[model samples]
Target: MFKGALDNIPDRVKVFLLSLTIMFCMISTVYANFYIGIDKVYTHIFYVPIILAGIWYRRKAIYVALGLGLFYIVACTVHDSIIDPDTILRFLIFLVVAGVVGSLSRARERFHSKELQAERAFRRVAKDLQLVLESTDEGIYTTDIEGRCTLINVAGARMLGYGTEEIPGRKMHQLIHHTRANGTPCPAEECCVSRSRITGVGCRISDDIFWRKDGTAFPVEYSSYPIISDEAVIGSVVAFRDITKRKQADEVRSRLAAIVESTDDAIIGTTLDGIVTTWNAGAERIYGYTAKEIIGRHISLTAPPDVKDEIAGILGRIRSGGRFEHYETVRRKKDGALINVSLTISPIVNNAGDITGASAIARDITENKRVERELQEAKAQAEMYNDLLSHDINNINQIGTGYLELALSAPNLDRGVRELLDRSLEALQNSSRLIHNVRKMQEMKATAGKLAPVDICPLLDEIRAEYSGARNGEVRIDLACGNHTRAMANDLLKEVFSNIVGNAIKHSAGPVHVGIASEEISLNNKTYCKVSVEDNGPGIPDDLKPKLFSRFQRGNTKASGRGLGLYLVKNLVEGYGGRVSVEDRVAGDPSKGSRFVIMLPASA
Candidate 1:
């Protein structure tokens, strides 16, 4: 009770109380000196307060001891009138008792102060550790030897969708991972903590599942380390995180790998320095080298010796962020035979937008090259034969016409013979026209870039005059023009209108009337010259109009043409970036006549 009271009292009050205690001891000594005999036992009576003061106030007790000892001496001197050995000895004892008690109490207080500081430091360290554990993103938890959860951080509780207060004191496997990823029951024996305890060693599980409070599960990768105490396995500390994104990325990578392997074109990956990193199955067939032989080797292995630096040059361009698509080159197979390949190559960029490598898709074009070569050779030979035939056949028709004309010119010929010779001459003339038309068609094709601006008005006037004198003036021609009419074409533009007028004259037994009109028109934001050639010859049959411009097709059967005249017109106009179409001169009345409309790109 006294110690408790002293604890609540302030230092000044304690000192005041100690001073009263000294006064009480002094009063007792004074009363003894006056009322009773001054004895040796009473002389040292102040030692009692000294012991009390030392117990309560430690080193401060010396003042109490001095007060008691001084009052006793004054009382003795007044009573006995001189300092005695007993008084002196009593003062010395008071000092000795106070010193001894104060030293013991000071030492005790220092020890208690150190102990209090150590306890406060321990609590501070524990608070800091808790904060660190809870602040981390990865879920951290501990389990006992029985696989029960004993401690969990806030992160762990939040990951399991549980409150901090509700997480601990439960079986860890049953709380967050009750079932296997396959949905089968997971026994406690298969738990990570249980296994850790049994084996007395730590283990890591990279792929697993953890259940949430809502009964949904997500992929997790966790590691469980053993918690050792006294050199014995006690529990486990588990650290885990969700790995759903990583799993999805791996699946995408796997699908891309499958597609790359299944394709028929060679898909190759190489480092920016030309080192081959990946070779798909198609590459194996094209290069005659298996993936195992090609991968990790230099890309130059497949390059022909004639172009050994080709692959290195491509890699250099790729490193500079260049792409080569449909680039044809020759490559050497494992058998040392060269093959043509079309390559579409691009740079491979990483997430940081840095070009790391190159991807190339190569298609074997060796067979296509061979077929192209054969076609070109065949075309050359055909052109040669066509040139020879046109030359020889024209000469033959000229000779035949001359012989027939000579026979018709002979005097005194029979009427029937004269008629037969004239008919024969006409047949030869038609044959000569057919050969000339064929040569014109071949010439247009061979001179693809021979187009220049030609005035349509001049060509129309020329065609009109040339046919006006034909067949003894049996053909009538009319011309219409716009002064600004001009088109991009070769000299073959005259033949187009001439054929129309000639067709009208040849297909009619009487005078043929042809109207040639030219005007400038605009179509699809471009300038063009539209010319309509209306002929009064027997109109084209409706059924034959669609095939009129094709080979071997003719107009009305009664006045059928050689079929090449209008076909030639269609080809020449189209070659100059124009269109040609034929329609009934009178709408919906094919018997009236045919109107051929030709639109040509107008030159500025």
Candidate 2:
């Protein structure tokens, strides 16, 4: 009851009470000194108020000591007492006690004030720590060295499938971690939290399992941190989180890696600078280099010297995030043999979507390339044989024609023999035409080069003069062309016109009238030169016209020569980036003869 009353007293009231006590003590001392003839005995009572004031008021204790000393001096003088050495000594003692006690009290008050501030700071920190523990998703709890749960946050209680009323004061390991993941015994002594308390060090376990209140277990990644006080291990804090998703992701990656290892194609990984970083078993079988032998080596080790630039180009593209599919190239094997390979390369990206390296799958295409080359060689050989046979047959036909001409020119030759020789000569001419066409077809297949500008007007005139002179007065040839009629064509342009015009004259029954005209035309926004060759012969039937440009196809049975003339003309014209077609000279009249139209790109 006294302690409670002291705590309730205000500072001013306490000071008033102390002053009243000091005044009472001073009066009693004066009464005892003067009336009772006692000096030191009653003066000792003054020490009580002085010491109480020092303890209560700190520096203000000096005023009480000084007040009591002045009263004693005034009382001594009033009582007819002379000031003696003892009195002076007693006055000095009052001042000394006030100074000493006041100074000590001030120091103690300063110390007490600092301690109060420190206590307030500690309270704020504790509040903040509690807020953090309750807010986080991770399970957090503390346990004593004996494995008893001292405190558990809301998250910890929920994570262990327990309520707030049920979690605390229970044995922690027995409540949530009594058994291992595989249903084996896990006592409290062997628990990670207990071990941390004993060892005074933190413990972390990634692949461990923690049981819930329902007797079910889940994979967990957890850390146990020992809480120390006064250099002694007191308890431990365990922070844990579920890791089921992480384990699932690791399993998926393992399966994908297994598939890559089992594939037959060579799978390799290289850094952006072309240094080999990964090589699978397929790479060892295909390139004859194991991962131990080739990893960290430059990718150029497998590339032929001639294809080094090719490898560099591939790396450059991959670095720019470009992917290549089925890129066929050549590489060198371990045995110094060159092999063809088809490569599919893609960039390897990191989590930040930055290109770090490249992955490539290479397939051996050597056998495919070998078969292609063999087929090409066989085709070339067949063409060579065809060219030789055509040349030989043309020579024989020319010899037979020459003999027939000589025999027909005899002065006394019989009419019947002349008629028979003329028929044989015509047959020989037909055979010669077939041979010539075959040779031209072969030349067209083998020729390579771009077409040049050829003046259409002059080429047409030359053909007209030659054909007219050959027929003497039997045919009439007319040419109509502008001065600057030029087309993108080569020397074969003349042969194209020769076949068209010659066919017109040969297929005509009476005097043939062949007219050639050239003009500029626009097709598909591009300029081209259109040349037309018209004759007054039997026009092609609608049904046969479609096949007129086909090899060995004749428009009519009455036609006199091999039917390769129009076919050769179309192939040669189109080879110069031109188009050729035949139409009736007069639209709807089959008897008006045919007109062959040729279109070639106009030279700028």
* Highest TM-score scorer: 1
Candidate 1 local lDDT, residue 371 = 100
Segments in model 1 whose C-alpha atoms lie over 4 Å from true places: 1-188, 191-194, 197-200, 210-218, 226-236, 259-306, 309-335, 338-364, 401-513, 518-529, 536-551, 562-578, 600-604
Note each model's CA RMSD in angstroms: 6.1, 9.6
After aligning candidate 2 to the native by TM-score, how far in Å is the CA of 341 from where it should be?
Answer: 6.7
lDDT of 2 by residue, 341-382 (tens): 999999999999999999999998898899999999998898
Predictions in order: lDDT: 0.85, 0.84
Can you list the residue pairs that collide in candidate 1? none
Per residue, candidate 1 scores C-alpha lDDT tens digits across 1-604 of 6654655788788778767867777677666767787554374446667876787778878877777677767777788789888888777788788989987778867876888889889989999989889889888988888877888888878888999779778888888878988989998788776788889878888899999999999899998888999998888899998888999999999999999999989999999888889999999989999989888888998988789878778888998999999999999999999999999999999999999999999999999999999999999999899889888988999999999988888999999989888778877887888888988988888877688899999889888888886778777888889879999999888888888777777777777788999999988899999999897777877888889889867766555347788889889889999989989999888888889899999999
Shift in Å, residue 556, candidate 2: 4.0
**Best-matching candidate per lDDT:** 1
Q: Give the TM-score of candidate 2.
A: 0.56
